[model samples]
Target chain A: MTNNSSGSRFGFLIPVIYIVFLLLPIYWLVNMSFKTNSEILGQLTLWPTNPTLRNYTVIFTDPAWYNGYINSIIYVVMNTVISVLVALPAAYAFSRYRFLGDKHLFFWLLTNRMAPPAVFALPFFQLYSAFGLIDTHIAVAIAHCLFNVPLAVWILEGFMSGVPKEIDETAYIDGYSFPRFFVKIFMPLIASGIGVAAFFCFMFSWVELLIARTLTTTDAKPIAATMTRTVSASGMDWGVLAAAGVLTIIPGALVIYFVRNYIAKGFALGRV
Target chain B: MSFSWMAWTLPTAIFFITIFALIAALGVWEYFSPGGGPRVGILRFETTRGDRLFVSLLGSAFIHLAWLGLGGPSLWWALALSVVYAIGVFRFV
Candidate 1:
C-alpha cells in the first residue's frame, strides 16, 4: 500500500516538475510584459510589482502589429493548403503503386525533409525575387512548401501504407473511380495523418523566422519578425517582447491540444 | 548583391562542376568497372536507399554551406540536385 502510494505521489510530482520547468521561461516573459521598461530592468520581481496591460494595448492599437497577425495567418493557411493538396496525391501514388523505382522515390522524398531549411531560404528568396513575387505572402507560402510538402508526403505515406492494399484493389474491383475511392475510402482511414501534417505545417510556419522574414518586408511581415522590432539602442521594450513571445505559444499550444488525441496513434504504424 | 557572393562563387562553381562530372563519371564508370556490390576496388554499387540518401545529404551539406558562407539564395541547386539524385537512384542505384 505504502509503495503504491509513493509511486503515485512521484508520478504526480513528475508532471508538476515538468510543467514548472516548461512554464518558467514563459512566466518570466509574461511577468516582464506587465512591467514598464524601467521596472523590467529596475529589479527582479517573481511576480509583477506593478502590472499593466500597457504593452498589450500598444500592440493592439498599433496598425503594424495587428496587420502582422493577419498576414501571418493568411500565409500560414496558404502554405498548409498547398502542401497537403500536393502531398496527398503524391503520397497515395507512392504508397499504392509498384512503380519502376518506388523505394528510390520514397527515400528521395524523405531526403527533402532531412535537408536543412537554411539552404533553401536563399534560393527561395532569389527565385521569388526573379519572379517579382518578393515581399508578398504568396512568396513565403510557396517557399514554405519546400519543407511542408515533404513532411506531408512522409506522414501521409506512413498512414496510407498501414491500410491494406486489398481494400484499394477491392474498391476498384467494385467499380469505384480512383478519385472517389481516394476521397471517400482512403481519406477517412488517414484522417489522423492529415491532422498531424497540418500541425507540423503550422508549427514550422509559425516559428520560422528565416524564410518568413526573408520573403516579407513591411507589407507581409509575420509576428515573429514583428518581435524583433522591440530591440533598439534607445532601450528594449521588454514588456512588448515578452508579451509577443507569450502570445506566439498560444497558436501552437491550441493546435496541439485540439489534435492531441489523434497524434498518439498516427504515422508510426508503417512506412512505405 | 554583397561582396560576400565572391567568397563562395569560385569554390561553389568549381564544386558543382566537380560533382556533375563525378556523378557522370561514376555512372559511366559503373558500366566498365569490375564486380559490383561493396567492392574495395573501383566500381562499387550502393543500395538504392544508400545512393539516394548519400547524394541527398552531400548536396544538402553544400546547400547549407552556401546558405552560411554566402546568404541563403542558392538552394535551387539543392532542390535540383536532389531531383537528379532521385532520378539516379531510381534509374541506376
Candidate 2:
C-alpha cells in the first residue's frame, strides 16, 4: 500500500517537473525582457531586479519591429484559411471513396509535409521572384501551402474517417445537396478536427523561418526575420531581442488556449 | 549560466528549442493518455510514436545529405522527396 501511494505521488511530480523544465526558458526570456541590457550582460540574476518596460516600448515605437509582427500575422492567417479550405473537400473525398490509386494519391499528399523548408527556400525564392511576388504576403502564404495543405488534409481525413458513412447517406436521403450537407451537417460533426487542423496549419506557418524569410523582403518580413536586426554596431540588443521573443510567443499561446480542448482530442485521436 | 561560449545564432537556437518543445509535447501527450501502443506498419515491425519520429528524423538527415552529395542545384525537389520519405517512414516504417 505504501509503495503504491509513493508511486502515485511521484506520478504528479513527473508531470510537474516536465512542465517546469519546459517553461523555464520562457520564464527566463520574460525576465530578461524586463531588464536592461547592462543588467542582462552583467550578471545572471534569477529574476529581474531593476525591472523596466523599455525594451517593449522600443519595439512598439519602431516601425521595422512592429511591422514585422503585422506581416507575420497576415501571412499566417492567410495560410491557415487557405490550407483548411483546400483540404476540406479533398479530405472528404479521401474518407468517402476508394478510387483508382486513391491510396497512393493520399500518401503522396503526406509526402509534401516531410520536405524540409531549408531545401525549398532557394527554389521558393526563385519561383516567387519569377512571378514578381518576392516581397508580398501572398507569396509566403502560398509557399507555406506546399506543406500545410498536406498536413491539413491528413488531419481532416482522420477526423472524417471517424464519421460514419451513414451520416452522408442519410443527409442525401433527406434531399440535402452535397455542398449544403458539407457545410451544415458534415462540418459540424468534425468541427474539432477542423479546429485541430487549423491550429497545426497556423503553428507550422508561424514558426517556419527559412521559407518565410526567403519569400519576403522589407514589405512583408516576418517578425522572426526582423529579429535579426538586434546585432547592430554596438552589439546584440539582448533586452529587445528577449522582448520580441516574448511577443512572438503570445499569439501561439492564445491559439493554444482557444483550441486547448481540440488539441487534446487531436492527441488522443493520434492524428496530429 | 554563461551561454556566450556556445555561440548560438537565433535560427540555430530556435531549431533546438523546437526539437525540445516537440519532445516535451509528446511527453505530455503520453502522460495524459498512456497507450501509444506499438503497431506494425508496412515495414512489418512494431513501432510507436517516438520510434516513428526518430526514424523520420534520421531519414530526413540522410535525404538532405544525399541531396548535397549529388550536387543538386535546387533543393526544393530534394525537400519534396524528403517529405515523401518522411511520410513513408511514418506510414510504413
Candidate 3:
C-alpha cells in the first residue's frame, strides 16, 4: 500500500495536467464572451473590469447564430440515428454469418471513416447536387453516413462477436423467431456497443465543418458555417467568434462525460 | 449519335476501374493465400489475424492515396473505404 500513494499521485498528475490544458482555451472563450469589444482589444484582463453579456445577447438576438445551432443539432442527430440503425443489422450479419464478399464489403465500408473531409467536399457537393439533396438535412445526414456507417458496423461487429453464438441457436431451437430473438436477447447484449457507436456518430457529425458547410448554404447552414459570418469591414468580431467556438464544445463535452467510462474498451468492440 | 451525347469518358473511367480491380484482386490473393503473419513489432505481433488486419488497413491507406493521386475518388471515399477494408479483414480473413 506504500506505492499506492505515489501511484495515485502520478495518476492525478496526468488528469490534472490534461484538465488544465483542456480548460484554458474554454476559459479564455468564456472570458471573452463576457467582455465588450473595447475590453477584449484594450487589455488581456484576467477578470473583466466591467463584465457584460453583450456577446451573449448578440448570439441570442441574431437569427443566424441561434438557427445555426438548431440546424447543426438536427443534422447531427439525424446522422446518428441513421448510422446506428444501418450498422445494427449489417454488424449482426457480419458477426453471425459466413457469407459471400463479406470481407471485401466490410473493408469498403470502413474506408469511408479515414477519408479527409476536404477532399470529399467537392465530390459530395456534386453528388448531392445531382441528386437534388444539396441544401437539405438529408444531404448532411447522408454525407455523414459515408463516415459513420463503417465505424458503426466495425465496432458493433466486434461487440456482436463477443456474444456467444450458442445464444442464437438456442433461441431458434426454442421456437423463437429471428426478430423476437434479436429484440429480446441480442439487443440487450449489445446495448453498450450501441451507446459507444452513437457517441462516435454524434461526435463526428457534430464537430465536422467542411462538408457540412460546403453542402448547405442558407436554410440548413450549421453553426460552424455561421461562425464564418462574424466578420465586418473593420475586422472580425473576436468576442462572438470565441463565444461560438465555446458553444461548439458544449454538446461534445456532455456526450464524452456520458461515454468516457465505456469509450476505451468499447474501441475494441468488447474484444479487450 | 450526337458528339456530345457519346462523349469518350470511358477511357479515363476504364483506367480507374482497372486500378480498383487490381487492388481488389490483391486483397483476394492476400486472404486466400497463406503466411499472413505481422512482419513488425510491439510487445507481440505475429498472428494471421493481426497481420491481415494490419496489412489490410495499411494497404488501404496506400490504396486510398493511389485512388486520390492516379484516380478520382474524394477523401471521404478514401476514409470510408478504410473502414470497409478493416471490416473486410475481420469477416473474410
Candidate 4:
C-alpha cells in the first residue's frame, strides 16, 4: 500500500513539474506584457512590479496591430473549415475504399504536408500573384490548406476507421441513403473525431507563420507577421510583442479547452 | 460601415471564394458516390485508405525532419527524397 501510494505521488509530481515547465514561457510572456521595456531590460521578476495595460492598449488601438489579429482569425477559420470539409470525404474514401493508386495517392497527399512550408512559400506567392491573390486572407487560408488538409484527413481517417463497419451496413439495410446516413448517423458517431481534427487544423493554421507571412503583405497580414514589425529603427517593443504573443496563444488555448476531452484520443489518432 | 469586406484585397476575396467552391465540390462528390471498401496494399497488413494516409504522413514528417537536420543549402533535395519516401510508403509501408 505504501509503495503504491509513493508511486502515485511520484507520478503526480511528474505532470505537475511538466505543467510548470510548459507554462513558463507563457507566464513570462504575460508577465512581460505587463511591464515596461525599461523594466523588462532592467530586471528579472516573477511578476511585474507595476503592471501596465499599455501594451494591450497599443494592440487594440492600432489598426495595423488589431487588423493582423482579424486577418489571422479570418484565414485560420477559413483554412480550418475548408480543410475539415475537404478532408471529410477524402478521409472517408481512405477509411472505406480502395481505388487504383489509392495507397500511392494518399501517400502523395501526405508528402505535400511534409514538404517545408518555406519551399512552397515562393511558389504560393507566385501562383497567388498570377491570380492576383496577394495580400488576401484567402491566399493564406488556401496556402495553409496544403498542410492542414492532409493532417485533417490523416487524423479524421483514424477516427473514422475506429467506427465499426456494421453500422454502415445496418443503416443501408434500414434504407437510409448514403448522404442521409452519413449526416445523421455516421457524423454523430465521429463527432469527437471531427472536433479533434478541427482543433488541430485551427492550431496549425493559427501558428503557421512562414506561408502566412509570405502570402500576405498588408491587407491580410497575420498577427505573427505584424508582431515582427515591432522591430523598427528605434528598437524592439518587447512589451507589445509579448502582448501579441499572449494574444496569439489565446485562440489555440481556447481550441484545446473546447476539445480537451477528445485531445488525448486525437493525439493518439483514435488508435487508443 | 457594416463590416466592409470591400477593404479586403482581390486575392483575399478570391482565396475565400475558392475554398467555399472546393468544399461545395467535395460535398457534391460525396453525395453522388459513397466510399467504404478495404483493400490489401504493399504493406504486410491489410490497410484501408486511412491507415496508409496515417503511415505516409508520419513517414513524411520524419523524412523532412531528417532532411532538415542533415543541413542542406536547398530543400529541393528534401522534396525529392520526400517523393521517393512517399512512394515507398504507399508501395510497402
Candidate 5:
C-alpha cells in the first residue's frame, strides 16, 4: 500500500516535467519579446534586464506587421468554416452509408491529407493565377481546404460512428425532416465531434506555412510570411520578431482554451 | 514595413461579404424552419437543405475551376453551369 501511494505521488512529476520542457522555448520567446533588441543580442539573461513593450508596439503600429495577422485570421477562419461545413455531410455519409468503394474512397481522402504541401504549391500558384486569384485571401483559404477538409471529415467520422444507428432512426420516425433532424436533433448529439473537427481545421490552417506562403504575395500575406520583414537591411529585429512569435500563439491558445472540454471528450469517444 | 500589403481589392472584400451574408441567411433559415427533413433523390443517399446547399457550393467551386482549366477566357459559361449545378444539387443531391 505504501509503494502504491509513493508511485501515485511521483506520477504527477513526469507530466509536470514534460510540460516544463515543452514550455521552455515558448517562455524564452515571450521573454525575448519583452527585451530590447540590444539586450536580446547582448549577454544571455534568465529574465529581461529592462523589459519593454517596444516590439509589440512596432507590430501593432506597423500596417505590414498587423495586416499580416489580419490576413492570416481571415484565411484560417475561411478554411475552417469551409472545411467543417463540407466535412459534416461527408462524415455523415461515411459513417452511415455503405456505398460502393466507400472504404477505398475514404482511404483516398486520407492519402490527400498525407500528401506533402510542397508538391501542390506550384500547381496551386499556377491555378490561382489563372483564375486571377493570386495573392488573394480566398486562394490561401481554398488551398488549405485540400488538407483541412479531409482531416475534418476523418475526425468527424470517428465521432459520428460512435453514435448509435438507432438514434438516427428514432429521429427520422419522430416526424423530423432530414435537415431538421440533422440540425435540431442529430447535430446536438454530436456537437463535441463538430467542435473537435473545427478545432483541428483551425489549427492546421493557422500553422501551415508552405502552401500559404507560396500562394500569396503582398496583398494576402500571412503573419508568418510577414515575419520575414524582420531580416531587413538594418539586421534581424529580434525583439519585434520574438514579439510577433508570441502574438502568433494567442489565437491558437484561445481556440484550445475554448475547446478544451470537447477535445478531452472527443479523444475519449464522447464519454467523459 | 510597407502598408501596400494591407489593402484588399474591392472584389475580394465583396466576395467575403457575400459569403458571410449567405452563411448568416443560412443560420436564420435554419432557426426559423429547423425541419427541412432529409430526402433521397437521384443521388440515393438522403440529404437535407443544408447538406444540399453545402454540396452545391463545393460543386460550384469545382465547376468554376474546371472551366478555368478547360473552358474559354469568359467565365460566364462556368457561372451558368454552376447555377444549373446548384439547382441540380438542391433538387437531387
Candidate 6:
C-alpha cells in the first residue's frame, strides 16, 4: 500500500509540475497585461500592484484592434470548416478503398503540409495579387487549407479505419445509399474524430502567423499582424501587446476544452 | 464600372470558391463510384491508404527540417527528394 501510494503521488507531482511550467508564461502575460507600461518595465512582480483593464479597454475601443480579432475568427472558422469537409470524403476514400497511385497521391498531399510556409508565402502573395486578392479573409482561409486539409485527412482516415468494413457492407446491403450511410451512420460513429480534426484546424489556423500575415494587409489583417503595431514611435506598448497576446490564447483554450476528451486520442492520430 | 470589394478581393474569392468546388467534385465522384479494398505493398506488412499517408507526412516533415538544417539555397532539391522518398514509402514502407 505504501509503495503504490508513493508511486501514485510521484505521478501526480509530474503532471502538477508540468502544468505549472506550461502556465507560467500565460500567467506572466496576464500579469503584464494588467500592469501599466512603466510598471511592466520597472520590476518583476508576480502579480499586478495596481491592476487595470486599460489595455483591454484600448483594444475594445479601437477598430483596428477589435477588427483584427473578428477577421482572425472568421478565417479560422472558414478554414476549419473547409478543411474538415474536404478531408472527410478523402479520408473515407483512403480508409475504405484502394485506387491506383492512391498512396502516392495521399503522400503528395501530405508533402504540401510538410512544405514550409515561408516557401509558399511569396508565391501565394504573387498568385493572390495576380487575381487581385491582396488582403482578404478568404485568402487566409484558403492558404491555411494547404496545411490543414492534409492534417485533417490524415487524422480522419485513422478514425475511419477503426470502424469495421462489415458495417459499411451491411449498410449497403440494407439499401442505404452511400451518402446517406456516410452522413447518417459513419459520421456519427466518428464524431470524436471530426471534433479532433476541427480542433486542430482551428488551432493551426488561429495561431499561424506567416501565411496569415503575408496574405493580408489592413483590411483582413489578423490579430497577430495587428499586434505588430504595438512597436511604434512611442516605444512598444508592452501592456497592450501583452493583453492582445492573452486574448489570442482564449480561442485556442476554449477549443481544447470543448474537445479535451478527444484530444489525447486525436494527438495519437486515433491509432491508439 | 468599378467597385471596391469589401474586405475581399478577386483572388481571395476565387481561391475559396475553387477549394469548395474541388470538395464538391470529390463528393460527386464518390457518389458515382465508391472506393475499393486495401492491397499489399512493397512493405512486408499490409497497409491501407491512410497508413501510407501518415508515414509519408511524418517522413516529409523530417526531410524538410533536414534540408533546412543542411543550409540549402533552394528547397527544390528537398522537394525532389521528398517525391522519391514518398514513392519509396508507398512502395516499401
Docking class for model 2 is incorrect
State the lDDT of candidate 3 residue by residue for A37-72, as single tens digits. 899999789977898877778888989889999999
At residue A228, candidate 3 shows an lDDT of: 79
Instruction: Point out where model 2 deviates above 4 Å.
Output: A1-9, A232-234, A264-272, B1-93
lDDT of each: 0.76, 0.86, 0.81, 0.82, 0.86, 0.85
- Chain B of candidate 2 versus the native chain B: what TM-score? 0.79
Clashing residue pairs, candidate 1? Answer: A122-B72, A122-B73, A123-B73
lDDT of 5 by residue, A169-257 (tens): 99888888989988998898788899989999999999999999998889999999889755574488889889999999999999999
Query: Predicted candidate 4: what Cα RMSD to the true structure?
Result: 10.4
Error of 1 at A159 (Å): 1.4
Tens digit of per-residue lDDT, candidate 2, span B1-93? 333445679988896897778667766766676655569998788877667766776787788889899898787787788779878887776
lDDT of 4 at A138: 87
Report the number of the highest-DockQ candidate: 1
lDDT of 2 at A185: 99
Better of 2 and 3 by DockQ: 3
Q: Which scores higher on DockQ, 2 or 6?
A: 6
Which parts of model 5 are misplaced by more than 4 Å?
A: A1-7, A264-269, B1-93
| Model 2 chain A poorest ten-residue lDDT run | A98-107
DockQ (0 to 1) for model 4: 0.04
> How is the predicted docking of candidate 3 categorized under the CAPRI scheme?
incorrect
